[model samples]
Structures are given as structure tokens and as C-alpha cells.
Target: MRKIWDIHGGIHPEENKHQSTGTAIGSIPLPPEIILPLNQHIGAPAEACVSVGDKVLKGQLVAKAQGLFSAGIHASTSGEVIAIEDRVVTHPSGMSAQCIIIKPDGEDRWTQLDACEDYAQLDHDRLVQKIRAAGIVGMGGAGFPTAIKVNPKSNKHVKTLIFNGTECEPYITADDMLMRERADDIVKGVQLIARFMGEVEETLIGIEDNKPEAIAAMQKAAEGTDIEVVVFPTKYPSGGEKQLIQILTGKEVPSGGLPADIGIVVQNVGTALAAYRAVRFGEPLISRVTTVVGETLTTQRNIDVLIGTPLSFVLEQHGFKAEKKQRLIIGGPMMGFAANDFDVPVVKTTNCILAPTQKELPLAPPAQACIRCGMCAEACPASLLPQQLFWYSQAEDHDRLKAHNLFDCIECGACSYVCPSNIPLVQYYRASKGAIKIANAEREKSDKARVRFEFRQERIAKAEAEKEAKRLARKKAAEEAKKLLAEKADSPAAANEKTTSKPGAAAAKPQAADPATQKAKLERALSSAQSRVERAQKALNDEQEEADEARLDSLRARLKQAELKASEAQAKLDEFGKAPEVTVGGEQAIKDKMAMSPRDKLEKNLASLNKRLSTAQERLAEAQANGAATVDALKMGVEKLQQKVNDAEQELAQLGPDSAAQGAAETAPALSAAEQAIEKAKAKAAAQASMSEEEKAAAKLEALKARLEKARARLTKAEEEQDENIDAFRAGVEKLEQKLTELSN
Candidate 1:
């Protein structure tokens, strides 16, 4: 016999085990349908692998485990899948989960099995995989995956493997009945787990003194083996994992820790039997022994119920008296919850379905205020301050509740049982635990959001700094180029070149007198002036329509100037004549102009327009900086010059590439500003024309990305200022984003 250690607090309620133990473990007839919930255990819910209308076999893997902590779900009987949708499941809250409903065909067919003649021949990893595939969980009610408990980390050596057969709860006798009948199978499972654990020090089966028949059967089965069947004084809640560990090995698991941490592993006796069947016979956990007991039933005993069998169906098998039943609860009364619906199906974790009469298990009286009687404190199995935790829970003070070790409370209802005030102390602790978890999750989410926001701000700031650096670098380069130009212009070689080229430059000016060339220039001037006039007139009309006096006066003045320019351009065109034929007197002049070539003429024209644009832009900037009245007129003049420059460059581009090369070589030594601008424009056009469609798309995508960044910046500024055009800026940003996405794709 092993010396047993007792826990701090416990209370023995009425032992209602005799009602279920009178009869042996029995099986119910196959129901018409079985409803299997994907999530019958803790951790992530299993994902269904079967669809409605699919034929499935008994022990078929209908759902696969989602992760390591979860367990797979198997069909209980050979059937056709009828439905796969949300249905009421066996839960404390009576919640609905994804279920696979099957209609039995009465055949009880099974898929091929890979049974092992001897589990000892398999390796540790193979054994664990086999157990995991079996879908076995802690049938003792915690529903923790059995594979995870048996297989600890390599460094954490397990010394003891204890089987829990205490069944200390009020009316649960599923394990008790299983032990009395299937003792040898349970011992075999214990040996298999011990082998999986490498070299466990001792194997012990912990039972309470109240279960004498179970103790004797387990001892007889454990004979000639190192496994020990240890019995101790019966106490309420001793079946708890931690409590059982303490009672069997005198070792207490650390708070918020597991038995594996203390070199020990505990598994429910039912789980052992399930594992044994799974490994030895290649059977999945399709059914479990469940105690059906209560005064509201005509018959009360343990039933080998198929997983997913509806509670209503099971109750009908035993002649349940609905009118006499006060409440329907799953598990034992100490830790069970009232089931709201009879349609809820039983799961692997359901040990007992308790339906009691009003007189047999009457509802608790209405809760009264706490009286500080100290009885609850004495009866707390976890040695926690129930009164303090209850107070903090009522106040919704999560920090204080955590400080009082509220999570350590096993919610055994011992404190509530001893309370004179009838306060549901355990309910308060459960609610507080839920509240604290939610609060912690929300706080963690907030922290992540804060981190992301800070990271975005830093990225934006870095981009801005880089942009500023590039601008300064470009400014410096331009200043250096200007300084070099000035120095070259003052050099003797430049002076000699300029002096020598003056006559040719002067000679080239006379070509402007040619009738054909002069007429074309005047026509172009007229077209540009008319375009400016239209733009200014439109601006004035828009202002007038809006009745905005501030911009109307400036717009009118700009329109008047544009009209004057247009009139002068028309007069020049009329004076020059529109006829295509030139007079004999100007025939020599046309010949001289023709010698310069059309490409040279267009290039020179582009150079002149570029100079004029540069001057106009400078004047506009100065006027705007000084807040001058001519700011609007200067801006209009700059726009017109830019348009003329673009037109000249386009005409130059129309000339053949050979002509462009010839022109570039002729003006290579001392390139003018307009010549340089023409060269750049021509090169750009040639590059674009040479590019493939994909290359062009890539370039456009890059430009769109840049535009989107600038637009987003503007939108941010507008939003910060609460500007009236904030919506317009936001729309612009979205448009740019859409374009970018399309181009990227």
C-alpha cells in the first residue's frame, strides 16, 4: 500500500452512486441517427472531412483534428451522412456547433483497420500517432487530448503514471462500472502508456474507499505487474487531476501548471481502456460508458452510449419522466451545468447525464447577500479566498480577482455548499475568469495596434527625410551646373566661338523672312494665343457662375490680356499672307531657309520656347512669393510658353531619327538650353517607343505609385485640417490606388 496524502479542503455530499451501479454496463439499441459535433474536446474544433449525402462506415474519420491540442471525430456507426450544419451540442452553455448528422443503416459496417498484434512492437512516435488518430481524449470529463498527456517533452521525464478511478463526484459511475468490468483492459492500457513514457518509476491506480468492488477488480487485474491499485479515504472532488495526483503520490502540481511538470502523468481509467482498444484492436473512440441516473427516470444505470446520440433519444430508452425532472445536467452535480435543451447530443467528455426529480435534487434557494460566515473559506478545495474572489467578481475588478488566485479555484461548488447565504460562489469565479480572459485579449489587441501605428509613423517620417535629402541633392547639382556654365561662358575659347558663330547666327535670322516659314510660324502663334484666350475665358466664366468676386476681377484681367495677344497674332498672320506660293522676290530667301533644314528649324524653335518658359516661370515664382498683383498673369504666360515648348518638341520628334542625330552632332560643342531640352525630349520619346508593353506597364505602375503616395499625404493633411475638400482629396487617393493596383496586376 502507498501512503496517501490529503488535500486542504473538501466536503462529502450525498452519494447517489447506488442508483446507477445496481446494473452492469449496458448498451442501447442503435438510434436512427447520430449527431457528431466537430468540437467535442478542448482546443481548436475538428474540421469535417465528410459532406452530406456521403456514405460513411463505423469508426470512419468524419472529422480531422485541427491542431495538436485537438482530437479527431469518428462516425459511431455505418450510416449515410444526412446533414452537416450547426446543431445543439453537449455544452455547459448549450451552444450550437458544426455537426455531421448520420442516419444509421443498421449494418454497423467498418473501414479497414491496422491493428497491432502487440503494442510493444511499435516505437514511441508511432504509438502516439496511433493514439492521436484514435480520437481518444480524457473521458474523465476534462476532455484534454490523451495523446498530449501521455507524450511529454523529451527533457521532462515522467516518474509516475496514475490512473484515476476515484469517481468522487455525487452521481457519476461511468468509470466505476468500467473499472468493475474492464479491469484487465484498463491495466493493459496503463502498461501501454507506461511503455510510451520510456521508463516510468511506478504505475498506480488511485481509487476511493467508497468503491470497494472497483478496487478489488483493479487489484486482481493488476496482479503480477508493477502497477499498484491504491485506495484512499473517499472525499468530494478528490477525482480532480491535481487532487488525485496529491492523493496518490503526495506531490502537488504547481498552480497554473500541469502534472507533467512534476515528473508525473495522470489519465482517467476510461481513457486508458479507450487507448487499449484503440492500439490493440485498431478501434477509434466511437462510444463511451455514460451513467444515466436520476429519480426522474424509471430505470437508472450505466449505458455504453454512442458518441453523438441525442440526450432525448437516450432518455427515451430509459423511460425519462419529463414532468418530474427538475433539471437536466451533464456530468456530476458538483461541476455540471443545466442543459437547456434535450436535443443536445452527448459527446466524449460527457460522463453522466443527470436528470433528477424536484424532491431528489431540488433547485437551490435564491441567493442571499454574503454574510462573511467563513464556512466557504474553510471548504475551498484550492485553499483560495472565496469571499474575496466573489467580492472582486461582483465589482468586475479583474486585477483584484487575478491577485486573489481566482483561476486556481476548481469551481467544485464546495464553497457554495457550505455557504449559509446560498451564494453561488463558484458561478462568480467562473464568470470572473471569462471576463478576465476577454479583457486580457482586448488589451493584447490594443497593444498590437499601437505598435503598428507607431511603425507606420516611423516609416512615413523616414520617407519624408529621404525625399528632403533628394531635393537638396538635386538643388546642389543644378547650382553646380549653373556655376560651371558661367565659368565656361567667360572663358576665351567660349568668347572666340561665340564671336565666330555670331555671323552664322545673324545669317540664320534672315531665314525668318521666308514666306513659307514665316507663314507657318505665324499660324502656330495664332493657334497658341487662341488656346490661351479660350482657357482664360473659361476661367472667367466659371468664376462668374459661382458669383465669386475675389477671383472674377483677376480672371477678367487675364482674359483681356489673352484677347490682346490673340488679336496681335491674327494681325501678324494676315500681314504675312496665307498663300502656299512664294513671290519671286522672296524665292532666294525661301531657298536660304530651306538650307537650314526642317529639323534644325524645329529644334531652334523648341530652344527659344524653352528659354521663354524658363523666364516666365521665374517671374511667376517671384510674383507669387511677393504677393504681387501680376501673379495670375505671370502664371498664365508661363502655361502658354510651356504649351508652345511642348508643341515644338513634338514637331521635332516627327522628323526622322537620322535628322535628329545630325542635328545633335551639329550642335554638340556648345549646346544651347533649348537644344539640350530638345535632345532630352527626343531621347525620352525614342526610349518609350522602343520599350515593350510590359516595360511600359512597369513604368506606368511606378509613376502611379508615386502619385498615390503624394495623394495620400495630401489627404492626410486635408483630414488633419478638417478641410472642406477632404472628400475630394480622399477620392483622388483612392483613384490613384485603384490605378496602381490595375497597373501592377
Candidate 2:
């Protein structure tokens, strides 16, 4: 039994093709001006080789190819480029791209160019270069760079060349007519490609049976060349490159990969004609055959149009008929965009300007929910689960939609056509895909900011804590050292009394008693001082190390900060000690804890106390500083010092200080000058307390201004990228102002 295969596809959408293909080819007169878009292919836009004031000739290379993947632009007729700026393009985005506006002289003069013979003699790389320079791109719907299709340096296994003469698309017969008229040129172009493939195995030209005339013409054209022209059964999208390749070679291209991966290369019939021009005439691809067909047009012809010609002009030339008009489609009604505006340009891939009226092709009604009917699934050529994707996409469940292979759906509009629900399936899929992309971008940016900000804040906090611990240990060592010295000096005074007792003086007492007391005190004092120094050593070891690079760098920064702070703190400390107490009649100096934050005011007081202690130690430098003052002097100053210290200690204890007290003492040098007062505060503490409220308010204002400035800058950047956030900016500012007012109140 012979095997029969039929791939899943849509119902027969109305062709309405008779209006254009029924008539023979007719000539279109040149317009006064022809607009040329710099980009007509699916790669980098061509760079303008001709300036605004420069003149050009018919079929002259006007724009240089931009990149290896880019196509070149040319002048279709001798003209002057009056402007090079944004003009409408037949882009799915419906947005304008850069274009060159030409005012043609209508004489259509040909530029002097080098036409080559024996193209096989040229280097393969050079051939590809010429093709790229000539601006030849895939003319079959997709305007991919044609040079890219042939140069499969990456994949050397492609052994077969397939020529596509299968114009299976409904209502468009441009390729069919071209094959009928230029079959010999098309075959010659194929041989030129065969020159590169080098002794190619077998060349195959596939056409659908519906185009018997094209197949007959190609059969004669390829008569003795070993190129086999086969006719396959008629089918929609048989003209599709991958689809036609499968029908001819029985090869199914793996998803997301190309035909080259499977040892095959496909070229369209019209593309072959362009190749012949590139090789034989040295002419670039500047014009294309546009099928003007529909009930709306007064006259329909396969007009050769210059690229970037406005759709409006094309429609006007034929006389627009609005009678019973429903929609204006750019390509065939099966898979094409309905024209929202008439300013779109004719690009390299534009095959037809299909204007089927309501009577010709009626618009469907409002979409109804899917009833789980599988007509859409059956119609899907890629074998996707359309209904499943539709469900997730409508619910905005992006992950599920992707998991169901939504990307594979090709937006052919077939699923919607057979859909009993009349669902606009493609629209939902497009919206979901766009939303998913935008969401991913936002998430990535947010994650990056969070990581950087958190790490910075953590580093700052850890550094401050490490510096504080070292300072406390140093202060404790100083206090203990002072106590040991006092104890050493006081022992001498007591020992003297023991030696002078009258009853036992004669027998027990000796002149050595004073020296013995002095020795005991010296020994004890030396031991205590050594212990103090040892403790300091242990603390210094634990505080920070030179080996931990990050920690060391942080400490060096903190030390500089501490040094800066010490200068300011010393000044205030000196002032406090020097200023005499004011004589208010029987009123003790009141330092109410509530009047100011312990963190600042307390630091000022602590600095003053430390300064007093430092000054007292200087006088006793010979004893405490040098460990050698006389016993009596050491005892006198220390005994009195301990009593005054006890009273000052009592005041600190009564403050009921918490962790803030240690922090206050820590901030003695780090703290800046005391703030004066808050503009508004509670009456009881208003006079003494100072607040950073005014400065904070000013800072907030500046921050808002900076945010606005940055938003403006971001908006400018967004405009360049074709993604603006002006509405988002305005909404956020409104929310910010509301929050600020609530906080202020």
C-alpha cells in the first residue's frame, strides 16, 4: 500500500484571487516621487551611501550594506534624495523606520556598473559579498538576507538544493506569473548557485499541481541540466519554505532549527530572479512585484513597485472602493495583518495589498468562550494545543502558557477560523507573550538592586560595631591601671604607722620596716601594671587583624573617621572644662536627662569628664604616668580622687542608662557639635532639645527633585528604546506626595 500524508491545517479561507491573476501583466507608469526605505529586509538597516543633495540613477546602489547580515538599498529610478528620516514601513510593529525620500526625474537612466560573466570563476566569499552588496533578500514573505540562506559555512552537510515554485498561497499569484515568464532566468540563477555547491548531486524544483503552466515552463527551462521539476498536490502553505521542503524531500525540520541542519537549502522563485540580476546585470534589489487585487481596486495588476512606496499611493492608483469594504489586509487574508493605517510602505517581502471587502471576506463576530472543541487543534500545522494555551493566556498564567508550548503557535489565524467559539486566539497569545517579557525584565532589575543595597548596608553596620568593641577595651585597661597605682602608694603610709607603735618599737621595729612596705607596694604595683598591659595586648589581638583584607580596609576607614571625630570632640571637651559654673543663687547645675538625647548631650558630658581625668593624670605623671612618684603624694591625690570619682559615678548610675549609655560614651569623639533646638517640640523639653527635622525635610525635597530629574532622564532613554514610562512615573509621584502629606501631618 502507498503511504498518504496530510499535515493538520485550517479550513479553506476564501481565495478571492480571480480579480488579479485572471488578468495578464500590465505596466505601471512611474510616479513623480518614490519613497525608498533604507531597510526592506530582516537584518540591519542599510547605511545611506547617497547624501540628501546627491543625484542617483535607476538601479544604482544608493545605500551600503550595514553589516554581514544586512542588505543594501538602491534607487529604483534616477532621482534626488530630498530627506533621510522616519517614514512608514510595512512592519508588524506598525511603526516608522528610517527611509530615503526620492523625487524621481522619470527618465529612468541606468548607472554604469560591472556586469560579470562566468560567476563560477569568482571566489565563493566574494560571490556572497556581491549578493549582500546587491541587497538581495528572501522575497518569500520573510525578508531574511538571501546571502545568509546560501552561505551555510556553519553547516557543510547540505547536499541538495530545492527551488520553490510552489505559490500555494491563496489570492496571490505573483510568483506563479514570474515562474511562467522568467523560468529560464530562474534556472540560470540556480546553475549559478550550483557553481558554488560544486558538482551538486541533483537539483529539484517543486511546484504544486495547481500551477501546471509554471511546472511546464520550468521543465523545459531545466531540460538537460539534471534538475528535476516535480509537481506536488495543491495545498495551502505548500509555498512555505519548510513545508515545501518536507513535501519534496520527506524531511521534517526539528523544532527551532533550520532546513540546513537537515542537509537541505530552499530558495524562492522570485529570489532566483533577483540573484540573476545581481550576477548578470550588477543590479541591487530595489523593486518588487506587488499584486494589487481586491474588489475595492478599480484596476488590479501585478505592478513592479519601488520599495517604500506608500500603501496609500498604491491604493489611490487603482482608485479605492469603499463600497461594502470591511478590512484592508497587507498580505493574503489567511495570515496577514489588517491595515490600521494606510501609511505603511511596500517592503521587500510585501507580495500583495489584499483589499477584500465585506462581501468578499466578512469580519467575524465577537469571540465566544471555547467549548473544548478540537477544530483549532486539528487545524494547527505545528501540532500545538491551542485551546490549552488559550486558557492559560486568558487567565494571565504566563508560566503555564509557556509550558504548553505557546511560542510554537505561529499566529496563522487558522485556529481562530475553525474555532466554533470564534475566539481571537492569536490576540490573547500576543498580549501574554509581551506581558511575560516585560515582567521578566522588571524582576531582573529589582533583584540586582536588592542584592547590592543589602550588601552595602550590612558592611557598614559590621564595620561600626567592630570599631566600638576595640575602644571599650582600651578605656577599661586605663581605669584598672590607675587603681593599681593608687593601691601601691597608699600602702607606704599604713606601713609607717605599724613601724612606729611605742610598745613593741624597741624589740620588733627596725629602720627596714619602711623599706619593706615600700618594696611590698612596688612589687604589687609592678605585678598589677604588667597584668593591665597583658590584658591590653589580648584585646588588641582580638580587636582587628591585618590579614582580613575586608575587615582591615573597613577599620582603616573607621580609624580615619575616628581621628576626624576626635578633633571636634576635643574642642568641646576643652570648652566644658574651662567654663566656670554660673552662680545662680543656691541653684545646683541642673542637667536633666530628658532635655536632650543621651546619645549627643551625654557624649559631650562624658568627653568633659574624660578631659578632667586626663588633666589630673598629667600632674601625677611622675607616679601614675611614670610609676615612680613618692608614696605620700600618690596617696594624697588618689584618696581625694577616688571620693570625687564616686560622686560622679553616682550621677551616671541615676540616669538609668541602657545600651544607649555605652553608645553615648562611644560617640564622645565621633559625635559632631551639639544640635541647638527643634523648631517645634513638647513644651517641657523644647528649649534644650535639637532635632534634624528641618535638615531632613530639605534632604527629602532634594531627593524628590533628584528623583524627578532621574525619571526625566530615564524617560528620554526609554523613548530611544521605544519603551516609555511616563504614566508609571506620574502615578508613583502622586502616591509619594500623598504619603509625604500624611507623614507631615
Candidate 3:
């Protein structure tokens, strides 16, 4: 015999088990309609797999498990899906949740199933998958998915397996009846779970002294095996996972820790039988043995009720006297809550449908204030300070509640049962636990968002730094180029080359230097100014956040200055292009050319022709030697050069000395005439430059009139020809007219 230990605090409520244990487990008639809530477990809700108007067979998957922590839901009988909407569910808050409603067709037909003759041939993971596919959960009312509980982390080695047959709650005998009837199946399930646990050291079934028949049946089934049936004194709430572990192994599970953390696992006997049927017979958890008891019902016994059967239907089957009913509860009287509506359906976690008359179970009076009594603390199975937790809960001090380890409370109603003032201590604890869970979830979400925001800010800062570095590099390169250009422009060699490359080099030297060089410098200034304008504009546009007003104003001002500079540079370049070129001392150059004699001019011409002929001959010879593509053109040029040389020599030979002098004297007259015209144009430009304001305005008006007339004529011609540039011509005419009017004003 294995010795059993005791927990910290417990209460022995009135044993009401005999009321439902008199008869064998019976089945209720098929309900006309069933209501299956999507969420029947502790985690995420299941997702619906069927739609309304779809025909489904018994044990068919109507909703799938949403995640690893949730359980699947199936049809309890062959039926047609009537509705898929929110309906009142078996929740503590009496709220509505998404559910699947079905109308049975009276035939309990089943779908195809995948059963394994021998579970030992499969691996541990395969067995767990089978259990998961069957939608089995902790049938002891916690409704935690069994698959998740059975599969612990690889590092934690399970040494003991405990089957909880201690149905210590008042007016609930579902597990007790199940143990008495399905002992062999329960033992087989224990063995299968032990094999899945990988070499568990010991297997023990913990039952109370009140269930002698269940204990003897379990012992007989567990005989000739390592499994042991351990019986202990009857106490309320000893079936809690933590308390049971303590009773069986004398090792208390750590606060806020699971039973697996201590190398032990406890499961209800009903859950074990469900696993056995799921793996061996391929039957999903479509129904459960629910104890339908209380004085309001004439027939009080355990019944195999289908999941999703309405509470009203179960009551009707038991000949319920609604007039005598005081309150309708779902679980045992100690831990169960009053049902707000009779339409709420049964779920996997439901173990009993308790309906008692007012004389049998009366409602508690209004709760009174606490007296700081230590009885609640003494009766607390978790050994927590209940009075202090209650005070903090009333104050809504979540921090204080956490410090008192409020999550360790099992909500078994022991504290409330022993309270002198009937404070409903368990209700306060439950509400506090929910608030803490929500607060923790919100905190985790806020932390993640903050991390993401910080990362985004860092990325933007890095990009801005890189952009600023590139801008600085470009600015330095532009400055260096400007410096090199200035140095080249100011060199003595540049001035000398500019002077010698123009016509009448000696006379033009006294005028301004080359306009091309100045224009190039102005163009560089314009480019730099434009670049600054673009950078400033980009800076303004990229400022997305609340920036300093002074900085924004400064950027705008810089952009305006850059634009002004760029416009000034562009105007200077345009003025430079429109300016006419002037040659000074033209008369002296004409006189020097006219002074040459005819014989001298002929000889000069002959020498120029001879020089050209020699150059052409050299190019022709080079082209022939290198096989150049321009060989034919070069040969033709050489022939032309020889002919010109012959003509020049013949002309030079025929000219006499006196004839050369006379020819030079006659050319002087024509040269004198051209110089007079050049002088007249220079005088006119000088007079215009020195004109007063009134005179200048009159001259500009006259010029505008003449331009307008010419533009109008061109516009008329373009219109006649239907030219594409007619609009441009018309625009030019309008501008000239506007200018003429402005100058006149």
C-alpha cells in the first residue's frame, strides 16, 4: 500500500455523492438542437469549419482548433447546421460567444475514423497528435487541452503519474461513477500515458475514503501492474492539481508553477478514459458522463449527455419541477455559479447540472464587510493571506495583489465557505486575477511598440547623417573646382593667348579681356547658386516633425538669396551674349594693308599658295603611306593646290613693277570708304550710351515700334501657311506690342 499525505488547509463539505451513484450511467435522448460554443477550453477559441445548411454526421469536425493551445469541436449527432452565430454560453460572466447550432436528424451516424489497434506501435508524438485530433481536454472541469499538458518540455523528466479520482466537491459524482464503470479503460489510458511520458517511475491513483467501490474497481484493474491505488481522508478541494500532487507525493508545487515542473502530472480519471477511447477506438470527445442531480429533478443520477445539449433539455429528461427550483447551477454547489438562463448549452468542462429546491440549497444573503478574521487564511489551500488580498482587491491595487501571490489561488471556494461574514472571497480573487492578466498583456504590447518606434528613429537618423556627409563632399569639390578655375583665369599665359588669338591682335589688346572666360565663371556661379537653392528646398520639404520656426525661416531666406543670385548670374550671361564685338584702331590696319605694292601683293600671294601646296603634298603623302580613308580627298586637294600655285606664279610673272604700285593706290580708296562706315557705327553706339533718360526712352520706343511691325508681319505669314509655330509668332507680336506701349508710357 502506498501512503498518502495531506495538504495545508481543506474543508469536508456534506457528502452528496450517494444521490447520483445509486443507478448505472444512463444516456439522455438525442437533443432536437445542440449549441456548441467555439471555445470550450482555456486558450484560443476554435474556428468554425462548417456553414449553416451543411449536413454533418456524428463525431464530424465542425470547428478546428485555432492554435496549439486550443481544442477542436465536433458534432454530437448526425445533424444539419442550423445557425452559426453568437449565443449565450457557459461562462462565468454569462456572456454570448460564437457557437455552432445543429438540429439532429435522429440517426446517430458517424464519419470515417482512423483507429489504432495497438498504441504502443506508435511514438510519443504520434500518440499526442491522436489525442489532440480527438479534441480531449481536462474533463475535471478546468478544460485545459490534454494534449498540451501531456507533452512537456524535453528537459523536464516526469517521474510520477497521478490519476485524480478524488471527486471531493459536493453534489458531483461524474468522475467517481466513471472510475467505477470504466476501470479497465482508465488503467489502459494510464499505461498509454505512462508510455508516452517516457519511463515514468511510478503511477498512482489518488482517491478519497468516501469512494470505496471506485477504489476497489481501480485496484482490481491495476493489479499485476506497477500502478497503485492510494486512498486518503475525504477533504474538500483536494482534487485541485496542486493539492493532489501534494497529497500523493508530499511535494508542494511551487507558486505560479505547473505540476510538470515538479516531475509529476495529475489528470482526472474521466480525461484518461477519453484519451484511451480516442487512441484505441478513434472516438472524439463528443459526449461526457454528467451527473444530473438535485431535489428539483425526480430522477437524479449520472447520465451520458452529449456535448452542446441544452440545460433545459437535460432538466426535462429528469422530470424537473421548475416551481420548486431555487437556483440552476452547472458544477458542484461549492464552486459552481447560478445559471442566468436555461438555454446555455453543455461544454466539455461541464461535469454536473445541479438544480436544487429552496429548502435544499438556499441563496446566500447580501455580502457584509470583512472583519479581518484569520479563518479565511487558515482555510486557504494555497496558504495565502486572504483578508489582505481582499482589501487590496477592493482598492483595485493590482501591485499589492501580485505581491500577495493572488494567482496562486485555485478558486475552490474554501475561503468563502469558512468566512464568518459571507464575503464571497473567491469572487474577489477571480476578478483580480482577470484584471492582472489583461494588464500584463497590455504592458507587453506597449513594450513591443516602443521598441519598434525607437528602431525607426535610429534608421532615420542614420539616413540623414549619410545625406549630410554626401552634401558636404559635393560642396568641397565645387569649391576646389572654383579655386582651380580662378587660378587658370588669372594666369599671364591665359591673357597672352587671348590677346593673340583675335583679329587685329595689337589694336584689340587695349580693349576688355575675353568675354568667354567671364561667361564661363558666371555659369559656374549660377550652377552653384542653383545647387544651394535645391538643397534648401529639400531641407524644408524633408522636415516632417515639429521643427524650430527660426530654422525654417532661415532655410527659406537662404533659398530666396540663392534664387536671387542665380537670376543675377543668368542676366549677366544674357547681357554678355547680346553685346556686340568692337575692333579699335581699324583705320591703321586698313592703311597698313593698302600700303603694299602690286608686285609685293603678287609675290605674297605666290608665297601663300606655295606654302599651301607644300602642306597639301605632305598630307597626301602621309595619307598614302598610312593607307588613310581620306586618301582620295587629300589627292584632290593636292592637285587643286598645284593649280593655284601655277596661277599665282603666272600672275606674278606678268605683273610689272609700276603696275603693282598703281593697283595698290587704287585699293586705298575702297579701304578708306569701309573705314568711314565703321567709324560712323562706332559714333552712333557711343552717342546712344551717352544719351539722357528722355532721349534713351524715345530711342527705345522707336525700336519697339519697328520690332512690333516686323513681328506682326511674320505672324500674318505663319497664319497663312498654317505653320506649327503660329502660336510662337503671335506671342512674339503681343510681347513687342506690350514693350512698345511700356516704352511710350
Clashes of each: 1, 0, 1
Give the poorly placed runs of model 2, Cα more than 4 Å off.
Answer: 1-5, 198-200, 432-745
lDDT of 2 by residue, 681-728 (tens): 344255334437776666666677666665566556556644334567
**Counting only residues 3 or more apart in sequence or on different chains, how many pairs clash (N, Cα, C under 3 Å) in candidate 3?**
1
Q: Count backbone clashes in candidate 1.
A: 1
Give the runs in model 1 whose Cα sits over 4 Å from its true position.
465-480, 499-745
Where does candidate 3 clash, by residue pair? 598-660
RMSD of each: 18.0, 19.8, 15.6
**Tens-digit lDDT track of model 3 for 1-745:** 5667878888987878889999999998898899999999999999999999999999999999998889999999998999999999998889999999999999889999888997789998899999999999999999999998789889889999998898889999998899899999999998888888888999989999899999999999999999989999889889888998988888998888888888998888999999999999899999999999999999999999999999999999999999999989989988898899999999999999999999889887888888887998888889999999999999999999999999899899999999889899889988989899899999999999899789768866976886687668667766876787799878999899777786854554254554655666676676666666666667676563446888777776666666556545654565567655534576565566566665666787788778767866776788789996445545555666787888788787787456654766656554444565797799999998899989988887887887788789878877986644689999999888887777667
lDDT of 1: 0.85
lDDT: worst 10-residue window of model 2: 671-680
lDDT (CA) per prediction: 0.85, 0.71, 0.86
On residues 52-156, what C-alpha lDDT tens digit does candidate 1 reach at each position? 899999999999999888999999999999999999888766678899999999999998887999678899899999999999999988899999988899889
lDDT of 1 at 342: 90
Clashing pairs in 1: 607-674
Pairs that collide in candidate 2 are none
